[model samples]
Target chain A: MNWHLIAAQLLNGLALGSILALVALGLTITFGLLGLVNFAHGVFFMVGAYAGFVTFQYTHSFGLAVLMGALVVLVVGIVVERVVIRLFYRRPPEDQILVTFGLAIVIVEIVRAIFGGKTQLFPMPSWGMGATNLGFLVYPNYRLQVIVIAAITLAAIYLVLYKTRLGLIVRAGIDDSLIVNILGIDVTKTLLAVFVLGAMVAGFSGVIDAPIVAVDPDMGASVLIESFVVVVIGGLGSFSGSILGGIIAGEIISITTIWAPDYAQVMLYLAMALVLILRPQGLFGTEGRL
Target chain B: MMLRAIGDRSTWRVELAVAVFLIAFPWVFPIIGGYANLATRILILGLFGIGMDLIFGYTGMLSFGQAAFYGTGGFVTAYLLSTGMLHNTLGALAAGTIAAACCGMIIGYLCLRQSGVYFAMLTLAFGEVFYFLENSPLAKWTGGENGLPGLPKPVIPLGFTTLHVQSNLALYYFVAILFFVGYWVARRIVRSPMGAVLRAILENPARAAAVGHNVPKYKLAVFTIAAAYAGIAGGLLGIFQGYMPPDAFSIDQSGEIIIMTIIGGAGTLIGPLVGAGLWSYLREALQNLHGVGAFWKLILGLLFIVLVTLFRRGITGGITDSIGLFRVRRRTAAAHVEEAPAVSGEVQP
Candidate 1:
């Protein structure tokens, strides 16, 4: 393939990876730290998108949309954690999966009801709309912005987890939830914050993704499956793993599309299967976890 | 020793009841607010759900891609019937079933090698592949986006009078018969020694393997059986609808089946019928009701969450458990001849 085509595809991959990384960040942290699978995380992403879409509609401002989407989903995440999810913490992993799966259905259905089944389109901000000319290749400016935004968000999360007190507690709890519990730390509040934060990321991804992809109730399901691939590929709880997995998945998808357009999407799973068979713990995953 | 003997008898009774119900459902349902079309749809969906129940409910494998087999079976039957390569309807249906089973065998072999969530994701990937394949490369035979239409109604010829099964009542009876027989067969398979093994696999796969059960073979066997059920159901769907929608292969279709099983009651034969009935009925009702369109799905989704949160056992399980309590009360009283009948009567809800 020519440089233009290759560059274009790489851009697409990186942009897509950014979204995956954003969404998987929540899943990885909650799963990594709290030991909750959070199957409803995708629905969180959808809700965030809807929140963004609505805020934009009302204010006619993209910035406000991101704020509203993130805030609303944060609340939603906490409510979910306090309500249905609280009872499941002590249950079996399978039960957790089932409950969350049911919650996902409920959330998606509610979104569908509130916003019709039609795709909700987010208008790109004036600055994010145009294409950028990169000497030999042309790229969508919106996609490039996504990469920048995603990188910033990733950095922010890294700072929070590595540099903040709450992040320290979460990491400590992740290593030994029982120890934290025995230490008389309010693990509940920490989990609630982490859940909200994770949810906010999912929402943020949704709003950011709106301009690039069609927004709908079922959108989260496909993305959710892909994120699972990312999580599996990147070690389940490793933040760095998610970024790596997301980028690899994005490239795999983009490159596959160049080679075989139809199989592009399917190849993601094939790659996942290959990875699982070869390295069950994933690239950044510890073998002990598997 | 006593528990084993009672378990064996209870299993036999459950199997017998399922058989009788299937045989009687067609004859009895038409009199009770049920249409032939609805019955036919239920049977096809029920057949498909059986496969799902086996994988998700019994084997604890939450697959999100059964539509692959359903579509594959439908396409094969439609292609064979449409091309006139298979004149006999029964023969075509058989071939369709076999094709689906073979596909299941291959996919299951690969998928069952992984456990839990990985298995679920793998199935979903394969499903997406099948969808792409059907819509693209196999479009010529599959009819692509439009899907194959004009599948002829099956006919059964008798010596005295050839039964020309076509039109409303006739087609209903034909489908009813197929569903009845299929349901009866499923009940047998579920109660068989093999079904026991599948259940064991679900309860604790590691322990089951530790006990010397060939877990993978059982998983693969059930997966194939489920696929075969989906295939036959898919074929019946083509026959019943007179056209198989391409959406049958869509992930949405697979998701709907999962919802149905969860709603009705997992690990119960009659659960699918109740689930499909509730889902289809609500969909129609909600759509017909004023001020609701696609939002009906939203309502259903909420209902699903409430159900899962409130009643994991589902409608069939709830009823069965209640009935079981009454039976226990009676049996416990019977064990003590001194107990009064009034005590047992008070226990009934």
Candidate 2:
């Protein structure tokens, strides 16, 4: 067995997993709080990449690009929540899915109209251009940075969700919104905050992932579906589950790519199906929460 | 009494009306600037949406993975015909439909364990699995990205005389006949006692189960039937275009069918057909207009959002609702007039 190759792939999987965890975290929280299956989440990811790309074109600073990616999507999320998602709270789950799916199409087409449908390259940030040599394998510095950034972001989210008063309300609401409402906490504000936070995370990951993957109008479709797998594997509304599910999905894809590249995605889906069949509520997910 | 008779299930007025519409669509559509090929495509999508309506509209299972069966049925039939394994077109279509139905049964069994959003996500993931399988692993048989091309036009053997569907009109008629049968079957299912159970499940699964109906069994059955509809439609698409495009298995295909079903009106059997016609016609028309080609989807998306938000019942639903309301108002007015005369007679006595 080539231990060195395995080690390299493992690290690559971690990097991929971190990004997926970040994306899934956003989806999980909104679903937990709002019970909305936001199909437009993927479009937000694409919008972030484009936002960052445009920012980088002008500022030429990856930091500013990242900030702009998050900020633009943050505003976009706010508008979408206020104008559209707010109305859907009383609607059925299928209605929410359909509206958001429509929103995704609209947003993607708008992007396509502004920037042609062709794939665009997001250059590696100047600071993240080189390779870092570990004992076993040399890896891209940007990917390592992504891991660090995602970890910090995840940690920050953890603090907000667990350590703060608002976090308590959010968590409680996830368990039972009606009970939380009866407790005199403002559930509406908390819901808005969580939704926007999820959107920002999606945007942030999209910009960070820009250098790694091709940037295109339709890029978010696959990411959205993958994150759905992650959310399912982690159990809907479970933070730790998202992280674990993301890593597992990442490892399954990367490791499978080593032998059968074509089966990487298939393996990820199979793993999800198995998780669903074996433990429908997910490994960390509490049953009946959703 | 006459109105009740007209509305009775024994009367085939609705069926007759639909038949007239189908027969006249080819000619009427051209008047509205739609061509033969677009009409055929509408029928195919409409047939696919009928199955979706059965599951979603009546059964209340909003699946996002129907393309799995669609592409499965299309590819299987296309592969069989293209490889010369199936000499009869109808046989290949049947084979494809059955293959898709089996897939649906398996997928439905697994997915039915969950309901609502979880179910949607699971189906979407599974749909992607089929898509990836087609794009990579099964590419040898499926023709990968290029898709299976050079499929022969549909030829139906009637035992005594064979029907060669060669002309565009002939192909349209061939697909139309199948669609009519599919529509008729779907109507039967919706009106049947079993359909009432499906509706009960849709309205309230807990209550449906409380009433001794097996909810899961009903869901799976309807889901399988829906898959059969998608399968036959997929097979027809392969024959219609004479080439099975890989996009048949795409998420877009699945999403678009749902959009069509919803936009036309769910729970209404003809709703999908109306939605398909509108969607296909608008798509073609918008794409042809100057400077509007690229933004057509964007416009449609905006329109879909508006409809979902404001007109939840969709075009056909809204029309039927208004018509019903008008009839009710007229009937009440007539009743009030008769009551006044009776009151005057009593006062005279």
Candidate 3:
């Protein structure tokens, strides 16, 4: 194996892992808090990119684009949870899947109808346009920036979850909802806040990554599936599990590309299958949590 | 009387009415700004939805990957027919259906291990794997995104005389017959011992298992059966269009079928057909609306949300439940013993 190429692929894997980590973070929080699989969470990501796309059209500032994208999606997340998804809190899982799946379709189709079938482009900013010199591996400067930004955001989330009273209540709710209810904490409100936070992070990731890839109606789909896979692999209810699973998923995709590009995509599925077979609860997930 | 007629489906009147409507569809559709092709498409899709309903509505397994078997059947049969490897159209279709069923067993074995949400997610994963395979590695034979084309129409040998079905009108009859037979056969399965077991599993699997019925086995069987139905429907799709579109394996197809099944009423044997009819009609109608155009999906999405929110039992279920309510009100003077079925579909849990 060429050490230089391996290093490049490994770096690329970390880059990919960061995005998965961002998306999976939202999924895990929402799933843990609400016991609802937000299928439309991916659409939030797509809308965020589009939100960024539209914002960039007027502002012409990359930072502004990211901010606007995240904010728009955050509002979208809140409204959607309020009107549509709020009803599903008491509905059966099957109905929940249907409503969200339908919402996903609607969102994708609306985006397509508005944007047409063409891929939207977002260029790398002049400040971060060039490659970064890392002795053995020269990486795209914007990707490096993305990594740092993602890490900072992740750290912020980790601190909020671990340090804040809200975070404590969230953890407490997951462990013992009955006690949390007895304690008179507004669990529903906190869950809504958590869900919206998750959506904002997902949207932030989308807007941040928009410059690197095609921005289209269904762009969030594969990312959404992968994030779910990461959550499952990392352990559905565990925060650290999502991070670990995201890295493993990112590495698998990137490493497989070195040997065979086509199989790189398939490798995620293989990993998921293997995980399900070996440990159905996932690596970090509690057995009874799911 | 109308409610009673609909509520009590023991008679063949409903089937007869359906048969009559189908027989007249090709001719009737043209006068109403519709075509035989649309009707044909609805029937084929309805056939597929019926199978999905068996798993989801009746058996309470919300599998999100019916498209795998569907695409498998389409590609297999499309390949054979286009390559001239299979002369008999029915034989090629059978080959495709059988291959899909076989594929179902393997996929089902893995997916059914995890019940509830896990099964649905696992199926989505595996189903997507098949889709990726279609687009990438298996692209050479499957034609990747381009899909297979140039399939010959059916030629039925009627005891030394052959009947060639080519025109849209003739094709409607051909497809209708197949749909009717499929529906009839499905109805039989729903009435069998296995069907009872499946319903038990749907309503209460834990209790059902404790009562000596093998839960996993039934789940696997129904999953495989659903796949077979999806497979046959897919083969028919290729044969119907003469070219199998690449979207057969798409997540959209799976979603569409589920929507149709739900809209028409899950658990109802004919609910999917009703749902397909309504869904297709709506799709065409919304697209044709002057201001809507591309916004039809947005409207439909809103409609789906509204439907799931208000009409939990769907169109057919809603209608029957209303009738059931009316029956209860009017028959209050009499001793009410027999309860009206909750869902329009007999198999619905």
Candidate 4:
């Protein structure tokens, strides 16, 4: 391939990578701290995207739309935790997974009933609408914005997880929730906050991704699976690993598309399967969990 | 001694009555429900649900990839039979089931290592991958998004006469027979030692492992068995409907099986069949009701959530428990009567 095409593919890879990072971050925290799979996280993402779409129609302001979307999703997440998920925390992981799976179906079906099954469109805001032409290649302006936003968000999350007390508790919970409780800290509030934060992160991803992909009730289904690959590749709960995994998956999809466009998605699963064979806990994950 | 003998005989009688009802379901349903096509569809879906129940209910593995094998087996059989390569329908269907089992082995090998949600996600990836393959690259073989149409009905050579298993009534008979056979086989599997081990794994993998059971092997075996059952059921769908739609590979297909199993009662052999019958019947009935176009799925979702919240044991399990309660009450009453004479003798002394 020519350098221009390669460069374009690289940029596309970055766009996909950014989305993966955002989604994986949502999964990483919930899985890392709460030890719950949260199969409905994808539904949360869809809800956020749909909320953003609605908000944008009303206010015509992207920032306002994102804030509204994130807030709505945050509330939904907390409500789910209080009603269904809290009961699952003490049960088997499979029960939590199935319950969330059922809840996801409910959420998606509700959205479909309300919005109809057709794909809904959201225009990229004026600031992120145009293309940027490099000397070697041209790239979508919105995609470039996604990269910048993702970097900032990733850094922000890193700070929240590493520097802040909440982050410390989450990290502690990740290592061992029992130990965190033994330390006489209020782990309950920490869990509730982390659940909300995870939902917000997913919400952010949804808002950002709405313009690039068609916003539909079933939109989150595929993205949810891809995010799983990222989490597995990057190592669950490892911040840097998520970034690395996201990039690797993005490149895998983009580069494979060059060879066989149809096999791009299949190849990603094959890659995940291979990874599972080689490292069951994932690339950067600690051993023994699996 | 007489009471114990009577109890055993009554249990056998109930089982025999249930078996007779299932055997006559196809012949009798049309008279009651006014739609035999719907009943056949329910049976096909029920068979698929039984396979899923084995994996999720017994083995404790929640897979989202059952549809992958279903689609693969279906398309393969359809292509072969339609292309004139495989003349014998039974042979072609058997090959399809075996092929799906092979696919299951490959997927299970990679996925079984990762337990819980990760395994579920991985299966989802595999399912999507298979869907993509069927949609684009292998469209020539799979017939792409439209799916393979013109699937022929199976014919059996009875030596004395050839029986053409065609039309709704005939296909209904064919599918009903297979459903019964599949149900019988699955029941046997559930009652076998392997089934007990699978239940053990579901209860506690660590304990199962510590107890010297090859947990992974059992998991893989059960997964393959489930895939085989899914494959056969899928093949029957193509033969029954005369068309294999791409929707078979959709996430909805996998989700439908999960919902059917949960709604019917997991861990019980007949739960999925009952669940499938209820779900399919409800959907058809609701759809036919005016002003319920796409809202039917939404209504079902609400129903599912309510069921999960209230009837975690599902319909079949709930009924079984109620029946069990009644039986226990009768037995306790008999025990009270038996004790009365002994108490009177003690009072006299």
Q: Comparing to the true complex, what docking class would candidate 1 get?
A: acceptable
Candidates, ranked, TM-score: 2, 3, 4, 1
Who is ahead in lDDT, 2 or 4? 2
**Comparison by DockQ, 2 against 3, better one:** 2
Q: In model 3, what lDDT does residue B272 have? A: 87
Candidate 3 residue B330 C-alpha distance from true site, Å: 15
Put down candidate 2 lDDT per residue, A1-290, tens digits, no spaces.
88878887888899999999999999988898888989999998999999999999898999999999999999999999998989999788888999999999999999999999999999888999999898678888988998999999999999999999988888888888999989888777887898898899999999999999969999999999999999889998899999999999899988998889999999998898798789999989988776
lDDT per residue, candidate 2, B126-197, as tens digits? 999999999999999999999999899887899999888899988988999999899889888877799879
Candidate 4 lDDT by residue in tens digits, A101-209: 8889888988888898899888888899878887667788999999999999999999999999999999988988999999999877887888888888998899989
Candidate 3 displacement at residue B251 in angstroms: 1.0
- Interface RMSD, one decimal, each candidate: 6.2, 8.2, 3.3, 8.5
Order the numbered candidates by lDDT, best leading: 2, 3, 4, 1
Most accurate candidate by DockQ = 2
Top candidate by lDDT = 2
Residue pairs clashing in model 3 are A235-A285, B267-B345, B267-B348, B268-B345
TM-score of chain B of 2: 0.91
Estimate, for each residue in B1-349, the C-alpha lDDT of model 3 and write its tens digit.
Answer: 1122233434566566667877987888778678889999999998899889889877889888899999999999899989999878778888998988888888898887677666777788778888888988888999998998888897666778878889987888888998888877777787678977887777677778999998999888888888888998999999999999889998878878888888887776677887888788878987898988778767777778788778766777777666665564444422111222232223423
Candidate 2, superposed: residue stretches over 4 Å from native: B1-11, B328-349
Quote the lDDT for B272 in model 2: 85
Most accurate candidate by TM-score: 2
- Model 2's CAPRI class? medium
TM-score of chain A of each: 0.97, 0.97, 0.96, 0.97
